[model samples]
Target: MSAADFLPRSSLSSLIDLLQQQGYRVVGPQVIDGAILYRPLQQADQLPAGIEQIQQPGQYRLIRTQGPRLFSWANGPQALKPLTFAPRETLWRSHLQADGSLRFEEVIETTEPTAVLGVRGCDLAALSLQDQHFSGDPYYQQRRDSLLLIAVDCSHPADTCFCASTGDGPDARAGYDLALVELDDGYRIRAGSPKGQSLMDNLPLDAATPEQQQQTDEQHQKACQQQRHLPAFEPSRLIHQGQHPIWDSLAEACLSCGNCTSVCPSCFCFSESEVPELDGTTSGHQRQWDSCFSEGHSYIHGHRFRPDTKSRYRQWLTHKFGSWVEQYGRSGCTGCGRCISWCPVGIDPLEALTELGREDVE
Candidate 1:
């Protein structure tokens, strides 16, 4: 359990075949629309092999690299959250019977055995947070229970990534079934759970050498060193600065479009509604992802609590970094940096939070 071994890169196809044979639909990063996105695949060849990514604040692009290396990209704007916690899903349905009686049918989510490959450690961290966030939610639980997490160490890091500062990544300690450190010749594989142990046992591999472990260590350290250094400011510290003028500056740069929340790995807010047939007989309840940045998200009985853009933006940043700890026993942001790349204006949460520590901010 402590040591790892090498899996010949050529035998990777066997792993995919094995997963497929076990009736698992493998979902992982693949090039789409000039960027990498998680998509289902039937073969290893379909994966974004030979692809590399370029990510920066408010920008993302994918380029073809020289060799056949899968999972060269760090991540796009998504994580495992969407695969388990769907963006839009029907909760249940009700229909009026011919005798005027009503019958309600529960919409149970189908659990397709899935294998999610190339999951980065930061995302594994986010998935852990979301697992706690949806503890008793049946829809989420069913889908999550069926996933086989194959986590890849973040050997390649983006400028926006700061998982090391959050104490969350570059490598994984928990939440993964299997963990991998990719090398040019093959991969160093370690089993994190019984499921992972079984898979590795079945695979053709050789005992790992000390040099391989050295390479893994070097790559991990290099990833940790690549993060854009963020100023140290505890999330709880922001709760006292309710009247800070940083809110106004954030509001100006923010479009209130809610792109950041949508792309975030840990944000789990949603709104529900009832939809009825035009004849008024059958109806279904639905839930869709919601953002606090929306104008109507804060509306109460007859008034919107946070009507202004500044108030909404403040709510989001504070909730993500500040109050989320009180709610979940940990900070909400995993430092994945999707919010920076996906935001239309590239609003960096790291910069915003650090600025709140300044004395000039009222």
Candidate 2:
């Protein structure tokens, strides 16, 4: 840890200017279409100031507040996943040549160096998982290397959040260039990387006072006292529950709409296909984000392994909480609770897992 600096709320614009001057595209949370979305930000005013996100099972609402804080809310539906692992991208294109020889060209997207602000701790952990999964992938590496992560300690966690239990969040710990703790009139900022330190050097910042550091600690503690939690269960135990009846019960409520996976910061499933031109002159091979809940996800060799909603739901839960540990040394979930809040039918995975854990004990 390094000595922290204080930047008054008014000096936020100066930080943005510095990023732009360094030839980086600045993106941050903005109020758009009734939600806070990450978009290109040219100025500090574009941040969702005086706004708080109220989230619960199956519901998310934005409430206008009198507070001047910019990053008070816990999180939004999207995370750092979309920035590095693109939802839809062309891998390569094959063109028919005049001499009948095929020409295959890899499609590597050219991206501008970007700095994203207002990142939460859970998302930062999720991004680490993504980096591990996409290791050696050129497309993912290109975007990953070009990103500058600016994280904010979550002050007001939604009721659905359980990052405290997962040991991933509420306070920005690691994986960010810069971390911010929002105060009433300013922010307590610290650099986690050399790039962030360089930026801090350029900013006209004051040494963080003891009182401001105390305030930041209190906010982190408040966020940790959230309502939801993943149950105490061995991750490997879920692998044996394939035949459990809970799948059928969950299937009754699970729309299999894949909303949970979409909003989940760590869900990395994607499908690839080839698209041919009508004239057969050229074809493109592209990949897009996919979910285990989808029927086609289990389709292979003219047969679908997970034909019913029960099987599909079982696969998702088992893999996310069980087998993921074997592959990644941790559960797939970062405990951000996006899945619980975004599910249209309010299927809480934490509660479901608790039930399963109880069943195992019984």
Candidate 3:
């Protein structure tokens, strides 16, 4: 840790002004429909200040607090996934020609240069994974390149958080241009990239005091004391336990709603389809986010490989905790625990893995 710069909370709006002046669309967390979501910001006051989240398996709630800190909550339902890899996009379009011939055009949506604030460490890890998965993909690369990341360390982790167990965060480690630690009056900030350094040089910042640095360390320690965790077991163990009885038991309570994959920051499964307009003059080749829980995900040639909930659930768990390591050199889960907090039936993967590990010992 090095000496850092401090920005007064009142002057936070100036940061937004500077970014806008630099032709960057600033996106940040805000309360919408009772949930925190990332949206375009015009000023710092638009942030979800004095808001805290209470999260548990199958539950999420927001409550207003007396504190003035802006980035107190652990996380939200969405991550950087939507900002980079779109939920639905057209790859190309085919237009009917007057001469009875067809012409195809690739669709590359114009992207504005963006600066995202209040990013979390687990989401940063997930973004890195997505970067690898979409490597060399022009659409993803264009969005990835046209962005700046400003991460905030978690001062209040929810009960569903297991990022520490996954070796990801409560603090921003890497992959962010700038990092922030929110204190009572303002933020302690540091630069992690050249772009961040440039912004730091321009902001109305003062040298961080020792008291602010101590408070930042204490906040980080508090966040690290989270209750949830991934059990100690080789992730490969799940790959070999394909026929384990736990799958059947889990399927009994599972909804197969795909909420887990939808909220998972690192899940990259998708399905492509041809969407034709009613006039039939044009058709679009569309790619949409998909989940392994969907029966159609494994459907091919009229055969649904994972025909039941059991197989589908097994596929998801195995791929997330097992084969993903072989493919990406790490578990697919960053352990943000959105899947646990968002599941309708309160099906917790951490508990499921613990049960499996207990069975292995028995």
Candidate ranking (TM-score, best to worst) = 2, 3, 1
Note each model's CA RMSD in angstroms.
1.8, 1.2, 1.2
- Residue pairs clashing, model 1: 244-362
- In candidate 2, clashing pairs total 0
lDDT of 1 by residue, 1-362 (tens): 34547887888887787788888898877777777788987777778878877778888778888976786767887788898899999999999999999999999868889999888888888888898889999989999999999988887778788888887887876899988888877888999999888889888888778888788789888888988765667677777777877888888999999999998998898999999989899999999999999988998998999998998988898898889899888888877888988888888878877888663343
Candidate 2: where is the Cα deviation over 4 Å?
A: 1-4
**lDDT scores of the candidates, listed in order:** 0.84, 0.90, 0.90
Error of 2 at 113 (Å): 0.2
Q: What is the TM-score of each candidate against the true structure?
A: 0.96, 0.97, 0.97
At residue 314, candidate 2 shows an lDDT of 82
Give the alpha carbon lDDT tens digit for every residue of 1-362 in model 3.
44448999898887889889999999999999988899999988889989998998899999999889888898889899999999999999999999989999999998999999999999999999999999999989999999899999888899899898888998888899989888998988889999998888888998788888888888787788864778966677787787888898999999999999998999999999999989889999999999999979999999999999999999998888888999999999988989999999999888778877876677
Error of 1 at 32 (Å): 1.3
On the 0 to 100 scale, the lDDT of residue 286 in model 1 is: 96
- What is the C-alpha RMSD, rounded to one decimal, of candidate 2? 1.2
Stretches > 4 Å off in candidate 1: 1-4, 360-362
